[model samples]
Target: MKILITGSTGQLSQALQTALAGEGKVLALGHKVMDLTKPMQIRQQVRLLRPDLIINAAAYTAVDPAQGDRDQAYAVNAIGPEVLAEEAAALGVPLIHYSTDYVFDGRKPEPYHEEDEPRPLSIYGASKLAGEQAIQAVGGQHLILRTSWVYSLHGRNFLLTMQRLLQERDTLSVVDDEVGAPTWAGTIAAVTADMVRKWRTGTGGPSGLYHLTATGETSWYGFACSIAQNLERQGLLRARLEPILSADYPTAAERPLNSRLNCARLQRDWGMVLPDWEAALHQCLGNANAHQANHSMQATQSL
Candidate 1:
């Protein structure tokens, strides 16, 4: 299977590349090669590549910046996917897209299911929801995976941010009110590859939305603390951290208080199971440490 991964440089795309290394012929396209802001670029790229499967990992994820720059967000996150879906439908190729937990208002006391009605609170969420709608309306084979609190070893994510704060400051405060899963890109990518393999041999692709996230849940503050604990175990951090509320840490975009996603339906359909968040974090941090060690070794060799 010739698989095309968009947002080539993103954490998830990178992980997908690594996970699907021996699975198939993988082609990665980042913003530079295939700009989502320009729909024509996407259409042309798909025409040129003629890939069997396209995984749209690219999205405008700047939550706060999206408040003021809604046009750019809509262009990339909303209209861009719609263009890709149209192109994919034209070519009869399957599209695998990613959405967010932010599509919900986070008011429910339980984890959000795939059937839950989306009530996006921010422009970013609204744009992503629009993209999801477009993919459904395109009448093509597509797998829409909605995840939350994405983090990886080598990305600008909540885990890395907390690690930096711990290194730079003596104390840190994180929002405790918000709750979600700290999903690893590696897991999501692996599951995606599995799905691709199955789709290749199976009768047909599951053409609808699914929630793929780590098992268990945590607040932003809980997530930060877990990162600190893991780093401390690795002898990488030594700072005091405290938990606060969302009201204390204000942002232009309103975040959902409950971002947890139920993956039962996904498990039943895909036969994929997600590991616990802390285990995922530990593995990711170990990867980060290993990468740093390799880089340091290369620097010493050069010296």
Candidate 2:
């Protein structure tokens, strides 16, 4: 089955590309190839690809920047998916998309279920929720997976930020008040591929919203410290780190206090279990190490 993935260069898209390479045909398009900002571009691309499934991995993910750039965010996160869903509906294809845990105000005491009514805390969350509404409104075969605190080998994410800061600075402070699962993009991508493949088969079940995240939870402080510990174990520690609350690390946007998502529904329906956040973080750091090694090797080869 031919699958078309938008946001080809993003972390999740990169993971999906690597995971789905041998399984089936994946047409992963970047901004240059399929600019989602333009609705006509999405419509034309969907028509041309004629894919069985269109996984929209692209998003306007500048959470803080989104506070000031509502138009750009709405175009990419809200209206862009609306256009994609319309075109996919026209072509009779399943649309798989990603949402965020930010949709909730983070005031909930327990893990958020798929049925929980979304009350977005910030503009980014509001925009993503809007996109989710659009996909659902289309009434097509769609799977909207809401994930949180995503990190990967090839992206501007928390893990990378911690690693970079650890390399450059002598001391660091991270927010501990905010909590959520540090989900790995690779895990999300792999599970997505499995879901899509099942859909292709006769056994694939209904399409709806689900939460896909790592097994456990941690704060930015704990997550960063774990990375630091791992780096120390690897003899690469270079920075001193301190744990602080969300108030210490102020941002333009207000972060949810509890970003945990309940994946029981997803696991029960899809028969999948994601790794723990700590394990996922280790893997991301490992990937970063591998990437650095590759770059060094290429430089040596050129010399």
User: For all the candidates, what are their Cα RMSDs to the real structure?
Assistant: 1.8, 2.0
Give the poorly placed runs of model 2, Cα more than 4 Å off. 287-303
TM-score of 2: 0.94
Expressed as tens digits, the lDDT of each residue in 1-303 for candidate 1 is: 788899988999999999888877899998988999898889899999999988999889999999999999999998989999998999999999999999999999999999999999999999999999988998788989999999887668988888888988888988999999999999899888888878888943467899999999888888898888877877878679988989988999999999999999888877887899889888887887788889999999999
**Clashing residue pairs for model 1:** none
lDDT of 2 by residue, 249-290 (tens): 889988899999999988888787788888877777777779
lDDT of each: 0.90, 0.88
Worst lDDT run of 10 residues, candidate 2, spans 196-205
Best by TM-score: 1
Off by over 4 Å in 1: 203-205, 293-303
TM-score of each: 0.95, 0.94
